[model samples]
Target: MREGWEYKKLGEVCCPKNKIQRAARCFDSSDKILYIDISSIDNTMQKVTDITSVTFGDAPSRAQQKIEYGDIVVSTVRPNLKNIAIIDRYEPNIVASSGFCVLRNTECIERNYLFHYVTSDIFTQHLMKITTGANYPAVRDQDVRDSIIPLPPKSTQLAIVSELDNIKE
Candidate 1:
């Protein structure tokens, strides 16, 4: 770790306090919700491009994770493919598949910084090593939360994010 930087478990920096895992049936059947499945996101683009609008009753059992804007959603299945995206938009009815582990930033870390870190080779390699299953290698949400990250100062995080954004453009 660099000077002034500290190692922090991802769980320490982010995750909802209550750790609420709402069920899909919690919503009314007639209500329309924006559903994001693993396929709805373009991991390479780091963007969600194909959200579906479905009644709550029509939602798949996997469509149970509520998401807010800025949350990082990483696929728990087939992690080698690195399916992940940062939620840039939020609607009252937005929800994601349970196959994802939604990571919401807290005061200790910057959202973009965490997003970039999880999408990095270091993180992916670590995930690949710990993941189980041969045909469908996967990691539990706890595996993601337990991953350690080098947390730099907020200013440095912002600078890194800016440079990364520029590279993407």
Candidate 2:
């Protein structure tokens, strides 16, 4: 382990800042929302590119979580496939499927750092090992929260994320 680095459960660094579907339901039924599901994420690109525009009345049952600009959405289903993305685009009413484990970063952690960590091979391997179900092979939010992560100092975390971002670009 590097100096100034510490191991912590992923949950310690982030949380889900979500709004429930029931809140959306209580409002006007004719309003449209951007719904993100496993399919909405392009795993090959590691980006969300397939958001569905659906009216509240017709939204799927799985569209239960409301997400924000920087939240990281990890597909709880089929962990081996590695469906994950950080939300970059913003819309007022963006709801994600229950199949996603949405992680919003806390102040101590950099958003991109957490995003890169969960999408990394280390985290995928962790999820694959803990997932249940035969056909679906899903992981629970608890499993993701309990996964361990190595955190360097805050400055190091930002520097690492910047380099990774540059490589991606």
Candidate 3:
């Protein structure tokens, strides 16, 4: 833990939004939007590197929670499992599984820093505490909204991200 880096809940930095719930439309080969499910992410890295098969008409007509480049996507349903990913590309559309939480740092918070923190042991522990249910665990929208996070200056966040990247390399 570093100075000025406080613990904030996942909700403090992001809002929860799901793709419009409607009947799954018939799949068409020509559909434009790319469908990325939890399976698309690599188990260890939780990052999406390859998308082999694409299905059409599966996307919501009104995609309210589109994922943009640099945004962090977290799986809320099983926070203890620490399933998460950071979007580094500028995609026209990105939707996640119903249990996932999309976090958009409001420029004040560093997306990369938040991305790493969400997968840390400490954060995962916190999520486990907040999550409800035993057999079928679940975290609600309000639960994420009230989550606390450390608010650091941009420079510090950049440094943390750079350091983490180097360590990864």
Candidate 4:
């Protein structure tokens, strides 16, 4: 840990709220909704690339995680594969599969920084160790919330993210 840096539980830095799960019958069949499943994300790109547009009646039972732009959705299953993506853009009626744990940044942490941290090897390795199930290993949402993260000043976080973005380009 560097000076001015502190280790904080992810739940403290990022608040994961809006756990609204509606039954498929709650929505109208004529209404179209943008559905994002764990598989629809291209983790390498760090963005949601593919999504399905379906009527609420056609939505899968797992399509109950509501998402907004800038939210970070990470697949709780198979954390080693690093299925994570930031919700950069979406239609007004966008919902994600329940397999994902959505993270919303707080004032203490930058959104991009939180996204980068969750997708890093450090985080994934930690998850790999605690995740159960040999064939379909997965961690609970509380596991992700309880994990600790190193948080620096917002300015420093932005600088680090900018440099990483440059390297990607």
Best by TM-score: 1
Choose the strongest candidate by lDDT: 1
Instruction: For candidate 2, give the lDDT of residue 61.
Output: 82
Quote each prediction's TM-score. 0.93, 0.91, 0.74, 0.91
For residue 142, what is the lDDT in candidate 3? 60
Candidate 2 structure quality by residue, lDDT tens digits, 1-169: 9899999987888864333333255435687888898998999888998989988679888877778898888898998888999989878788888888888888878888998898899889888889899987998887888889899999999999989989989
Give every collision pair in model 4: none
lDDT order, best first, reads 1, 4, 2, 3
| TM match of model 2 to true structure | 0.91
Per-model clash counts, in order, read: 0, 0, 5, 0
lDDT measured at residue 3 in model 4 versus the true structure, 0 to 100:
90
Candidate 3 residue-wise lDDT, 11-126, digit = tens: 55554343322213323435555555555666588687654334445454422244667667677677776667887767654545555567777656777788887778877787
Q: Model 1, which residues run further than 4 Å from truth?
A: 20-26
Expressed as tens digits, the lDDT of each residue in 58-102 for candidate 1 is: 989788877788888999898878889998885877889989888
Q: Could you tell me how far off, in angstroms, the CA of residue 20 lies in candidate 2 after the best superposition?
A: 7.2
- Residue clash pairs of candidate 3: 8-148, 8-149, 9-147, 9-148, 11-144
Residue 125 alpha-carbon offset, candidate 1, angstroms: 0.5
**Distance (Å) between predicted and true CA of 113, model 1?**
0.6
In model 3, where do residues sit more than 4 Å from their true spots? 1-12, 15-31, 49-56, 59-64
Backbone clash pairs for candidate 2 read: none
